[model samples]
Target chain A: MPYSSTIAGTRYTFPDLRTLLACASPPRAGDRLAGLAAETAEERVAARMALADLPLKIFLEEPLIPYEQDEVTRLIMDTHDAAAFAPVASMSVGAFRDYLLSDAATTESLRDLAPGLTPEMAAAVSKLMRNQDLIAVAKKISVVTRFRTTIGLPGRLSVRLQPNHPTDDLGGIGASILDGLLYGCGDACIGINPATDSAARVMALLQSIEDLRLRFSIPIQSCVLSHVTTTLDVIAKGAPVDLVFQSIAGSEAANRAFGVDLALLDEAHAAVQNLGRGPDGANLMYFETGQGAALSAEAHHGVDQQTMEARAYAVARRYHPLLVNTVVGFIGPEYLYDGKEIIRAGLEDHFCGKLLGLPMGVDVCYTNHAEADQDDMDNLLTLLGVAGCTYIMGVPGADDIMLGYQSTSYHDALYIRSVLGLKPAPEFEDWLTAMGIMDAAARIRPVTGETQKLLAALP
Target chain B: MTSAPPDDDPFAFLRAKTKARVALGRCGDGLPTTRLLEFQRDHARARDAVHAALDVPVLSAELVATGLPVPIIVQSLAPDRATFLQRPDLGRRLEESSSAKLEKGDYDVSLVLADGLSATAAQKQGAALCALIGKSLSFRCAPPVIACGARVALGDEIAARLGAHLVIVLIGERPGLSSTQSLGAYITFAPKPGVTWDAERNCVSNIGPEGLPLAEAARRIVAMTALAFGIGATGTMLKEDDALAMLEGPGNSSPIDGHRDLQG
Candidate 1:
């Protein structure tokens, strides 16, 4: 059905739900590049006005991408919990936004409502929300997952110690890892984006990380962010694989562009489970998503990048991932354009992922070519911290030499944790305290005898 | 556990291990003033590198002096840097006026030097590398084309127009804080505009002083080019590992070594 709204005596009409959602979305370079954004500012507000009055059931009745054509659509339709949705089944999108912000949407209630919410529903309501609303609603929703350490706990934040190296040199990666450990980081996981996709190289990096974990007896998990196929090959060779990593997209075609699919993810999940790597919990997947992935691949099916991004969360939640983060600004200026667009995308991803019952984190980052700097990252980092984001990246000094981008640093993590009174995961906190790296108040102590031993142990 | 003396800087040794900014001293959970300024300084350089224009005349003089053909200057469909940064699709096609400059000819290879994201990289390294590869290839080499507001894929259209069998793009890589002037080379076989994908091209990145040096980068590029010609393919079908033995055999002293300290 077509939708229309009149504002300031000017009428704006959208032909379908997908077009309505696209036109209603805030300005982003990706949408504009794709020619999907609203042509005028007034038309955008008009589209939003029309979208606000949309019945929540309209999303169920009219699919954006047809159910038969897209497996992601099929998955959402097949798994939706009608019973959980009954409470707000009749509400409009704007009314649902009000409901989410009202006193009724407590932590437990949002958790129960998660299965009932579709990616479209979450996305539609998000367009109406300001940054504060996104934060306020997300802070109330607690989506916890576990592997080696508990993540997404209230009053806690985590950091993925990203010790990426240009050549995948073991010594360089080890040094960065040690640097992160001394700052009481790496509770979420110690992940590496290897320079090469060779299975042998991935195995060697995994073995080195596993060795460090064992030597320190650190309560942490390790992942080599490689292709799922390469990681599966490594796992079959009896390597210590803690988490299976993949870059997934919202559409079937886009996932195909990434050389991944649901069946492949399922196979990798089972393969990791067969290894029995995670004793703490069964959440074994670590997914990295960004808004512009589908569009960049020319497989977005005319959907806006943000809505496409939210749909990726559905794919992530199916495997019950331990970590799912949006590399918001990594795609460059083509998608996000600048700091403002990047910050909004980060908050939206965190809120959408958390609302859909996944441990969402933000790689508060930017490429040098993009119109963003460390100050913008600091703003998003503090905001995500306020929204109780599950985790953020802890690159060495926020400079990822291998990846050629700037992300939140270990010191940035410390700054957020200190100001927000957030603690690391409980198991990791205990390990830090025992190692004398972090004090009781969650402040990283001056590197002393214990940390020096860590530094000395690096090979 | 034995405590190290406070006077000794424990992290000093780690600085040599990787280019990653690690062991930066902290002042109460934030970067110390000196470290913070250092980061800001590096970031400023990187941001500036993205906007810095290519000195075409100087680069052309260097190429000509190195016994390379006088360059054909061109611009992509993107009119300016802002449009180039925001609209990558536009940067892949040749502007009409630039496209008209090429006449179809049976050249073995087309060399394109593009000011991609960081013109500083292309200006620093583009000429000498082009001369080295062009002179060594033992085949007919097209005049080098210097592209403004270009992306890597711009080489495809330029090469297709020249009727070259292979296209090698020596372009500026995205500036990172550690190295603002790093160049990258992308090689594609049987180049065709709008038909080629990024996966169809093999890339050799991080060509700078601190990363892969000029002689090694030239060796790999030539090896990959030869391999692509031999296999009739590039990208995923062509593996760099196949050329590894050739890379290990010998080192040719590069004429491009003098440009390494330009950033300093």
Candidate 2:
């Protein structure tokens, strides 16, 4: 059914729900590139006005990408807990937004409401929120998961020590890992994006990091961010796999473009759980998602990038992932355009993911081609810190030499932790103090004799 | 309780192993001034590399000096830097006028020098690497095509137009803070326009002084081409490990030895 709204004297009409969502989305280059954005600012406001009045139940009635064609849509519809949605069943999208922001939306309420909220409903309500609203609500809810250590607890922020290397050289990767460990980072995990995706290379990298973890007896998990298929192959060959990682997308078609499906994810998830490497090991997947992923793959099916991104969170929540982050600015300027768009998209993804009951993190990064710099990253980093982000990448100096992008540095994590009074995962923090890398006050202490012993152990 | 001596470089051993910016002493949870400025400077260079235009005439002359045919200059559908950056699809197809410049010919390899993302890489490394690979390859090489506002996939369309068996695109990679002018090579067998997926191409990346040197990169590309021919495939089906073994064979020179010969 066509939706219409009036502003001043002009009547604006949307042909469908997808069109309404696209038009109502805050200005983003990806939506414009898809030729789905509102032509004028007034048209956008009109669409938003119309979307605000939309009944929350309309989303269930009108499947955005046809339930039969997209398994993601099917997943959303099939798995929705109607019992949990009963409180807000009769509310409009606008009222839902208000409900989320009000004091009544306590931690327990939001936790219960997660199963009831569809990705579309979450995306629609988020469209009506400001950045602060996104942050304030996200801060109220926490999604904790356990692998080697507990993550997403309140007053804690973890850093994925991304010690990526250009050649997958053991020495180079080990060096970066040591550097990250010294900065009191790597509580979330020590993940590496291998330069090559060869199965042999993936196995070698997995063994190398596992060796480090064992040698130091550190309470950490390690993952090689290779294709899920390659990771599965390594696991079959008896490699020490910790977290099964994959780059996931919102739409079924987009996920297909990435050479993944829900079935493949389920297979990988089961394989990793079988190893049972970490403590509990219940959360065994690490997923990286971003805006424009569906559009970039030419599989968005006319929906906006933001909504598609929220749907990705739906896929993530199904797997009970330990870590899921949006590599926000890594897709470049074509999708995000500038720092403002990147910052907003990061907030939105975090908000949606957290609301959908997932341990959400942000890569908080940008490519050189994008119109962003360290300062832009700084702004987003601080905002995500305030939003109760689960983790951020701790690259060498905010520079990923292999991936050719800038992410949060080890020091940047230190900065956020200092300002926000956030500690690392409890177990990892204990390890840091025991190793003399961090003081009791949660500050990185100056290099001492222990630092020398740590350096001597490097191969 | 005592801190290490001030002059001792605690991270020096690790720093020697990787190019990653690690272990610069921090100032109260922030980067010290020297390290911060260094980051900003490298970032600025990388940003400039992305926007900088290729010196086509100089690159063309350099290619010609290496005994290759005169280079054909062309532009992708994207008219300018901003458009090229914004519209990647436009960069994957040639401009109408530019497409009209090439004549259909049967060739073993269609080489493309593209100003992808970083024109600085194309300008600095394209000609030299082209010379090395052209000298080594036993196959018939067409005159190199210099593409402006180009993406890696543009080579597919160009090679398809020329009826070449394979396309090897030496394009500028996205600039990183540590290296602004690194070149990348994409090799695709059985070139097809608008039909090929990125998975159908094999990529060799991080080609520069600090990373993979030109001589070593050329050796690998030549080896990969041979393996692709052997298997009648290029992409995921062609194993790079086979190419590495071929390069390490008794007769083949080491990468360092090849570099020395090139310098001499």
Candidate 3:
């Protein structure tokens, strides 16, 4: 009955729980007690308190990203289908983020009934560039996760500001969709919603994201708070911000599958010993999970490789800066989950829990599901560069590139050109000549109008 | 057999393909506990008195009455135990502004209600699940709002200021003495404001009466938010109840009925 407490100003300590209740294992009283005897993680810390009569600045959810400037202006003008921008049945539930911020998907005659080359989205982008050589000779390292995405991504969009994150990096929703998730996430990485902004709005969105990461220099990794609001905002902002706690939100909504909870390393070593100045400034609170909690995998919760090393040594025993993620998902559903055995149990729980310290991440999605294709988005982005999976979080006009631009089903637009081998890939005229959004078309096909308005904006 | 609704689909649904199934491991739903303490001494009242006697709004994101937005976060269980144990991070976020100033926010779909960890399940369904999920998404709602010092990512930071894709927070699930108001749902899809909880995020937890009930957890949170945007991603992988309980096969173990596995 003595955990530690204060009350008025704030002071509740865990200090490691009598050395884990003495090798723990007791708690199951009242209704059953799912877990909490505390053999160590330092006797499961349990109760820490200081209500100061409750409600300090608190507020919890606000924004740098929580939509409503007209549903993000109708999902930035979402074109017609692909399950109306990444959401399928239930009469297209809640109407696909307002059909991609609808104005009829940013008009321009939707690039003349686009799909660009239209010979059925150029045969589903030549069957996703010929099925990008799947299972690549069964190499199968399969399983990883400890932590990745130092910061930024899920895809096509992600932003939840209050660190001054309100709605405008000078509007136009940050050059249309948060600068394509900080320049299409090849590792500038992103994801921040720790209850929708404020810690001075996530430190003013990381000081306005280091002026777009020094003009996209891209080095933003680590931001996931709550084990007490990133340990009381890293102990009231001496400033370092690279958190990641636990509780895979009921394993992504009622067991889709990405489970493990070791109390996220005593709430990330109390948020890096109450906010470090050294020890790499604090970045290992890893152990996320997924199977469609919000969208599947993440800048963090990309989970699956199975219990990711007792969930990364229960977050590297009080946070030593571990890194584990399992990012794996393809479209949305054709029915009954697998997404390749949940990315092979999140790459076998980060390749056997990073040999004990925990580090095996591989998140991949691309999205736009309504029965996804383009060979399920180029075989899940070539299965994240042949499954080494250190990291990957997508969305930039993804949504299976908008269901291969609405193919009326030539096996869902050539199923990623016969599954990624690709004597075919690149359609909508090689993605409008790799993002110029048009021009390189020697004989591409759906020329119609600026290549079907850039294949009706991907996903 | 008096049913017709409830199967909204949680993408991983089970409870036997729905008939509004309720024999009572928990089916209390219409706010019982003596009418939830007589609707808290009344006035304006939940669903506004069955929507002023049926003018509508007696709860409708329809799963036979909003279930998915399951937040029950509450936190002050035994506080005064001397400064409530030091402060406990003050229990994350949520203070005065209450129902977060009744937001009436930019809306697309936002369901908040805080007090996390347990304030007695935020006074049981914090103001009746934000007045029944804003009267079931108020018919393509544009003004539905309610917050009370939120925190499970503050509804993805107020769903990034209401650009809202899907955010059914609810709050207050952290009490134990068996049950203090259980409730929990931290759903997310397009919901904005800093969006983190990785692997996307999803939940439709034991909503009162024990767990997973409120009209089958609002048809499992409108069928897992239409399957987290039709399976792009979300945590703990729930593709149609773990793929129909692994096809209702593999040694068929059996257990799932309520009380979240009776706590492992």
Candidate with maximal DockQ: 1
lDDT of each: 0.89, 0.89, 0.33
| Model 2 RMSD, rounded to 1 decimal | 4.6
lDDT of 3: 0.33
Model 3 agreement with the true structure over A243-349: per-residue lDDT tens digits? 44443422212222333333433554565555553244435454444323322222112211122112223223234443445434422221113234333333333
Off by over 4 Å in 3: A1-390, A395-452, A455-459, B1-264
Report residue A66 deviation for candidate 2 (angstroms). Answer: 1.8
Q: What C-alpha RMSD separates each model from the true structure?
A: 4.2, 4.6, 27.6
What is the alpha-carbon lDDT for the whole of candidate 1? 0.89
In the order shown, the chain A TM-scores of the predictions are 0.99, 0.99, 0.23
- Candidate by candidate, in order, the iRMS in Å equals 4.8, 5.2, 23.8
Candidate 1: misplaced stretches above 4 Å? B1-7, B226-231, B240-264
Count of backbone collisions in candidate 3 = 196
- Against the true structure, whose TM-score is highest? 1
Residue by residue across A290-331, what tens digits does model 2's lDDT show?
Answer: 999999889999999999999999999999899999999988
What lDDT score goes with residue B225 in model 2? 92
- The fraction of reference interface contacts (C-alpha pairs within 8 A across chains A and B) present in each candidate is 0.79, 0.79, 0.00
